[model samples]
Target: MPLTFHWFLPTNGDSRDVVGGGHGSPATVSGRDRPPTVAYLSQIARAAEDLGFVGALTPTGAWCEDAWLTTAMVSQNTQRLKFLVAFRPGFVSPTLAAQMASTFQRQSGGRLLLNVVTGGESQEQRAYGDFLDKDDRYRRTGEFLQVVRGLWEGQTVDLVGEHLQIEGAKLARVPDPVPEVYFGGSSPIAGKIAARHADVYLTWGEPPAAVAEKIARIRGLAEKDGRSVRFGIRLHVITRDTSEQAWAEARRLLDGFDPETVRAVQAGLARSESEGQRRMLALHGGGSDALEIHPNLWAGIGLVRGGAGTALVGSHEEVAERIADYHRLGIDEFVLSGYPHLEEAYWFGEGVLPRLRTQGLWQHPFDTRTPPSAQVPFAGAATAR
Candidate 1:
């Protein structure tokens, strides 16, 4: 199968520097130079769509705009671009969420994908009036998926699980094509729930060995449940015409990081209850030096970011090679973003995506009619100027 690619929506904001504010970290004021207005986000959405990304992931949390609302508005601006709406399951009832998904699918012509985020920080959850502990939150997510899945299958669900109870709950009009659930977590409980429920199991950008181990573990668990799930990795990218240019961009972003801000963000993330965040911290160790954890993988993003901190930094060919390596380890999807999303989308889309096509690993999702050479809409736009 052709590898699937997805981009991100900087709902909080966008900047040329590393934007903070994920998991438990506070939003970086300097990174908020370009506000996440509907116009700006629409430009990104249209660009990703024209560049052949399967979808765009819009995050949910206290730090960013609401996923559901932002995607709904953006959906009107683009055709054929799916929205991977990241949402916490506990804040809203499962039945209501199911109904909303149905409405979104119907209204947007089934351009909805759900990213189920079980809140990882205790204090952050409390800020939203949720008092459940981490373990309970995971349990609630499992139960919530059960009810939501049942209702989506057009069944009257009466699940009386430990965390959720639904009595004769049913959707008035079930979604024609149910949105695939994309889930990520690093704990044992999280692995079990993902194996049983998620259609796509997402992981942060880890080293090849670590990522392979995770794929093996998840595949085994899912097999036990008589299910198979696709795997995806989330990372930032810094591809350029040459290796030197790429590293220069990485250094520029690294240089832009304030020493105190990195320290403060790392300190804040230290209190995160997320196992995934813990693994991210392990990769970089909150140090700015020697950030290349693996070939072409730079961990500088984790210095101030809370989740998915590593980036693929190299020339376009090198970046494509790294992606191919991940694909060999069972990653069939990639959800990626960069310092400035609009221009970076073109960098990877025009430069690296063509190389991937040459290797027979990818094809434009919506432009099968066009040849590979004509796939990227702005292939020569930069030079044409």
Candidate 2:
């Protein structure tokens, strides 16, 4: 299968410097001056659409804007691009979530994909009125997906699971094309949920070997459930015309980091109960040095950012090669973002995607209708201010 690429909508904000306040942080912080306006997010959506990316992932959390509402408004701005809306299963009732997804699909013309984020941090989840521990949250997510899946399948679900009890729940009109579920977790309970329910198992950008090990783990678990799941990696990218330019850009972003801010964010994230977040912290150890953990993979983002801290930093060709390496390791989808998302979208879209297309690794999702020449260029595309 040709690799599917998705860009991220920085609902928190975008900046030339790495943004802070992700999963376990105090608040959404874009250290740079830019604010996350609807107009700005729409520009990103349009850019990702024009660049042949299949969708844009809108995150959900206290740190960022609401994914469901943000994506709904953004979806109105783009015709073909999908929105992988990140939502927590425990925050909202499963029936309502299913109905909202159905409404979103109908309104957006089937442009809804679900990213089920079972809240990882107990303190953060408590702020949203959820007191479940990490393990119980995963259990709730498993039950939540089951109910939501049943509703989407046109069943009158009356599941009385330990975490969820939906009585005679049924959607008035089922979603025409059921949205695919994208989920990620590193804990044992998380693996079970992904194995049983996820259409795509997502992971933060890890080295190829680590990614392969994760894929093998999920594949084995899913096989036991008599199911199959695709794999995806969420990453930041710093692709440029040359390797020197890309690394230079990476260094510039690194240089912008305030040492005190790094220490503060790292200290806060160290309290995270999430295994995935712990792993991300381990990759960089909240330091500004030795960011290039692998040949083209940079772990500088995690210095402040919470979720996906690693980036693929290299020339266009080198970035494409790393993507191919991940593809060979069974990563079918790539959910990518970068600092100052709009410009980075152009850099990767114009410089790197073309190379992937030429290498037979990717094709524009709407290539049959929109020709390459007619497509908008990311560099000069109007981000209507």
Candidate 3:
């Protein structure tokens, strides 16, 4: 199968500077020129759809808008672009979540994908009235998926588990085509559950060697469970027409950050219980200097943002090469985004995607959504009179 690519919807907010808030960190107030509004998010969804992204990942957490509501409204503006809705399992009942997924699938023409995020921070959990520790939260997620999966398969689920209890719960309309589960976690318990359930296992963008190790470890667990799953990497992307332009953009974003903001965000992120977050911290070492964690990969985003903090930074061709390298190492899917989403979408969509097409690695999954020869209207398309 051709490799798949997904983009992100910055649900918290968007800015020229990196907007920060996640993994137990407080939402830092910046001059967010683009609020995460329905209209702005719809623009991004339509742009990603036109760019040929398979789907767009909307995050779940206290810091951001509700993923379900945002995606449902945006889905109307899009034709075939799927919504990879990320939601914590323990917060919602399994039966309700299953039924909601069925409704979303039926309404959106089966364009619904699920990203199960097991909450990692105890304080963040307690903010929503959840007191479960890190380990217990994973345990609850395992139980949660079991029940949701059973219901989606048209099975009458009767579960009296310690975390969840559902009696004779079944989806009246099972998703005609069930949404693929995309899951990510770095902990041992998280891996066990992902191996048992996820259709596509996701990891944060780490170095090639570390990523290979994660793929192998997940493959081993999946094999023991008689299952096989695809792997995906979630990262941000910064591509430009030339290497100089790309590096300049990266440096601009880096320079926008004040020392105080970087220090505060890094301090908060250091307390994150998510192993992936820890690995991200390791890459940048919470220092103001030395960002390229790997070739064409920049860790400067982690200085403020939570979750997927790294980004692929280089010229369009180099970005495509880095992506191709990851594909060779067992990553068939990539979920990416950038600082100011709209402009960067065009950069990657036009600059990198065409190269991938020539290499036979990608085809816009939804070419029918736009005019066959539609092109982005770059500012430089015309010179001043």
**Which residue ranges in model 3 land beyond 4 Å of their true spot?**
368-385
Runs in model 2 deviating more than 4 A are: 371-385
Ranking by TM-score: 2, 1, 3
Tens-digit lDDT track of model 2 for 1-385: 8999999998888788888877788775757467788899999888888888998999888888888888888887778999999999888899999999999999999999999999889998888899888899999898999999999999999988988888999999999799999999998899999999999999999888889999999999999999999999999999988999999998898888888888888999999999999999999877777889999999998987888889999999999999999999999999999888999999999999999999999998887886434646685468732
Please provide the root mean square deviation of candidate 1 (C-alpha atoms, Å): 4.4
Stretches off by above 4 angstroms in model 1 are: 27-29, 369-385
lDDT, candidate 3, 361-380, per-residue tens: 99977665554236445653
- How far does residue 234 in candidate 3 sit from its true spot (Å)? 0.5
The ten-residue window of minimal lDDT in model 3 covers 371-380
> Worst 10-residue stretch by lDDT in candidate 2?
371-380
Best candidate, lDDT: 1
Clashes of 3: 0
| Collision count for each candidate, in order | 0, 0, 0
Error of 2 at 109 (Å): 0.3
Q: What TM-score quantifies how close candidate 3 is to the native fold?
A: 0.95
